[model samples]
Target chain A: MACVVLSLVGISAAPAAEMVRIPAGDYAPPLRAAGEPERVAVAAFLLDERPVTNADFLRFVTAQPKWRRSRIAPVFTDEAYLQHWAGDLELGPLAPPCAPVVRVSWFAARAYARWAGKRLATTAEWELAAAAGFTRADGKNDPELKHAVQQWIAWPVPAILPDAKRARPDFNGVRGLHGLVWEWVEDFSTAMVTGESRGDSGLDRDLFCGAGAVGSRDPGDYAAFMRLALRSSLTARHTTTSLGFRCARDVPEDSSP
Target chain B: MKATAWLCTVLFAAAAMAAPPPMEDCCKEAPPAGPVSARSIYQLDATFCSDTGQCLPLAALRGRPVVLAMFFASCGYACPRLVTDMQAIRGRLPAELRDRAAYVLVSFDPDRDTPAALADYRRQRALDGAWMLLRADSGAVAELAALLGVKYRREPSGNFAHSNLITILNPEGEIVHRREGLGGGLDEAAQAVVAVGKGK
Candidate 1:
């Protein structure tokens, strides 16, 4: 048994996954319902090198002083989260300013986008950009962003849906989508259906934490159920240490989704 | 000629004194929030202007007792109960003391709220004449809100993120007491009002 196990273990490391970068262009979700695929307009921007920092969001909050958090209407402070994210050094410069901001509500994120004079990227736009997949030769943040994205934009071949768990957003190209914080999508209602009451069923399940039925086997699936589900898990009604945002710009009329 | 000039001056001074500042029951000289900090007045400034442009400064409501609570006019369930509580409190007041106190309802929904909307909101509540529905253009709202230590936020579902706190202030602008949640009835709030008013 030992000899057999050792021989099986002799299998070499899996080769690095291929990355195919699709060019800057309009794209559609690889998975569609039985009928027509809804084509969303994809505007393009250079992705944030990483999830936005505390300083990035603080800039948004300070500029829109109207958005200053109020304790009475404290929507975003989950006792569980504050205990997890806050550091012990409250009054000092030792605090890490660039650590990702947490505990932001959806409204605040939208307000931040508006303040930035940009909008949150829609799921379709995000998927199209994410899909043209990338594989990193190495794993550094900046180079990873560039290299993985370059591989993603170059993806030429298609794989089956089940294989997509490892595939980048559009996997037709070698683009990378993993290892970053979850991105917010614009199609918020896909998680909700019409006529849902607070407890009846669907997205309005609970005020504090409800499931968004935008269910997906993989994050790459930007279907209505999956999109709705992503919106569901969020608790952003106030400033939390966990919440943050990124801005998406509109492509000139000449651009695509 | 000197006597005539002195008489004219006295008459002009009398007219100036007669034209008092706007709030009659209010305007007692009260100090800023001092050493005796109380919990009921947790979130203080009441600067949200109602649609009619009232700064709705709760601190301005010094001296004459105040029964202050927060409410959103659009609320489907909890709001009417809040009104009923205030009305019941008003019902308990002796007519003379009733005339001595004020009630202000500040809306957190500034985007859709207007002065006309506030007037309609007041009318719907059927609150007694002493209650004033107010709004402000963000700045005064923050000021008055901070004074009262009132906290609130807008939720993803378009409702407000708020706690239920009702405060009763003395004529001296001190928060004598507070009750948390919709459970505080008009009787409870009015009781606090009467207690503080009688002390003054």
Candidate 2:
């Protein structure tokens, strides 16, 4: 499967679409239940080469005016959603045109992805893709990558974003995944480190049969744990300065299956 | 000024004529009466298959207030009590008000919680006419879970670790209140249902 930039009507007006083809591979994520398979199979998919920029989102809102900040429903977003934008259509001085857009709620992100005929990457898929380093596809075992992620997590967020493509790309040709904004995963809500169901609730154990064994598989994987924690704490309507998202697409049948 | 006043009067009259009748009686099972609000959960275009083999958009339940929760049929731990808590809350409502409210249990395990499975679970739980056991496709499940703010993950073992939340939605499908955790007092939820049922 080849990843190429396709000019789509609803998503972007830019000359080149930024997408990368991720090959199908086996991923051993940090959060796994005991007795589960050691590796999970991830199907080949298309991912945005860089995070969605303010300009890209501007085009989306321009095409579908209902998604404009002023007109959006309260149910889909919190008060802070798109507050950084100077106006509904304007990116303002703080957000540069090429900077990754922030302060977008999960609902807004999902809608944007839908408008683009793409979908948000699942938590597993995001983790799998982010595991790549400069040289290797599966860098979960790389202490340097893990340390870099931790360092990024500790730093204060920059007031102004530089550019979506400023950071170097990873082995998969995906860029700015780690040292940039936290992404909105498709199944972010499913990161249930803490919620209504617990082993104490006998039925929850039955419902999530092996969940007792499903905690951090590698306690040393602090970066992964932090990401999981942040995701679970979020609501669909909540937005933040450090969170943004890119889009993904399943491989077409003729190309892969 | 005279023409503007006349126009205002005409517009007001049209709006009043278009207005739905006030739901004064908490017990009346009104048909879905108005356009769904932009914020309403019913805005989601998801189809749900009930235990009794009734397949319809979740919006079909818009005519009455609903108490909603998510669980899989085979959950061995907290789900049974979650159902009981739902039952307890429904029981606390006045009989007339009870008839106007719905108790909805949406299964997170759609693969196993088929219509047949949901039906069997409903039968075993002795759910009454006031209750609906529902299953949908995975995409619908994710959307509903996101809207409801209930987190869940299916383990490799086919069980789901889920958050326990009971959400109360008005007849318009707007979430009015939520009770979190396992097996808490249903008083708050019950009160919210009555208030919503009475169009408060």
Candidate 3:
């Protein structure tokens, strides 16, 4: 284990992971209607350089045995939580050490994030960070970025994902925001992009049923639309092979030390 | 104002100390007779402040069947109907059975729904007799909402758009039934409460 312990009084540190600082900024998200300001303001914070890897999660489960697949409360996770793993403490042979961890429920992800002295990124923070491409901080309008995201979305989820290192980093030096796995944002359930039960707006009520339906401000942002749709369908306990997560930390106050 | 300041003083003081015990340990003085079921909502470790300014562990209600709803005080639509739905369900129950069951409303807008706000809401609605409105920090609200499968979003107009869900939990804290949308569905929800009360 290459875990380093740096206990600076005011600085938060992680073991065996690289995190980069993301500066504060505002970006209009593409998921809304054409003219509405889908602008989300994200504050300065530290983000994991890559998604939490299988190896990283293995270490976490080892340390916090309460989250072991066998021991976890069903209220916190579904039956498939970490079912890909061979056992409570062992990974399947197909899971690579550096591949992003999959089959983690929101509760497990939240716990792991807490154990790492971090928290799951909020939706605004994640989107703001992900809006960056290799060259531009806000790539929502970059055709190349849009094309790359769409291409990744179209690819079938492989039985085993490749190393997180294989996914290219964005302008903010964060990796695996796309082209690896669908990340679990902290406020995913708040997406609320579904049909209104009271309002009869002639939407596809069948698909929107049992979801929080708020019309998108940018209907043309198909990628964000897909993300919101998927998010709206999920409960916190639901886990899937394509879903994983990364951790983030609030920038420590100067006086905290 | 004095009451608000006093409540804030008490709340912050409690927060400065250790987190209130997890739901399981909250009842250590008189622990639940058996192991908490894995599916019980009590598995979530959250602390909430009641409308009357009583700080409570979520598990404190473990022995009583609860009808819980998530709502905000300032909601212009849906929430008033949601509260009425709860009342309608309560009215459907036999008077004796109603006293045994607890009705809880947790706020989605904690920033605005202080204990005072909740108390005001309770008074305006004339809610009493095993009924309470509660507020917690934003993080706890999110976790409770997640456990209940309630979806909510804050809109630019300062109003909230959310799923209207009323959940019925057994005395052991397991969710027995849920009603979705505003108004109606009282019979099923009431029967759930009655059944859980008998089961306990």
Q: Write the per-residue lDDT of candidate 1 for residues B11-118, one digit (tens) a residue.
A: 999988896666743344343455223233323433555545656444466557777766677766555666666666777998878776887676766666677777
Number of clashes recorded per candidate: 88, 15, 7
Off by over 4 Å in 2: A1-16, A140-151, A196-213, B1-39, B43-45, B51-56
State which candidate has the highest DockQ.
Answer: 2
As for lDDT, the candidate ahead, 1 or 3, is 3
Chain B TM-score (each prediction, in order): 0.71, 0.83, 0.82
Candidate 3 residue runs with Cα over 4 Å from true position: A1-14, A30-36, A140-147, A195-213, A255-257, B1-31
lDDT of 2 by residue, A103-131 (tens): 99888898889878888998778878887
Candidate 1 Cα outliers beyond 4 Å, as residue runs:
A1-52, A57-97, A102-257, B1-47, B55-78, B93-97, B107-113, B121-129, B135-187, B191-200
Per-residue C-alpha lDDT of model 3 across residues B123-154, encoded as one tens digit per residue:
89999968878888877888888888776666
For model 3, how does the per-residue alpha-carbon lDDT over A1-257 read when each residue is reduced to its tens digit?
23433224113323466888888887555454223356867788888999999888888877777799999999999999888888997887867888999999998999888788899988778877887877787776677788789899999999988999778888888887878899998988766555432332323423222233434464666766677778767878889999999999998888231
Ranking by TM-score: 3, 2, 1
lDDT of 3 at B170: 90
TM-score for each model: 0.42, 0.81, 0.82
Candidate 2's residue-wise lDDT over B85-167, tens digit each? 89899889998888668899999998999889988887898888989999998878888888877777877778877777788
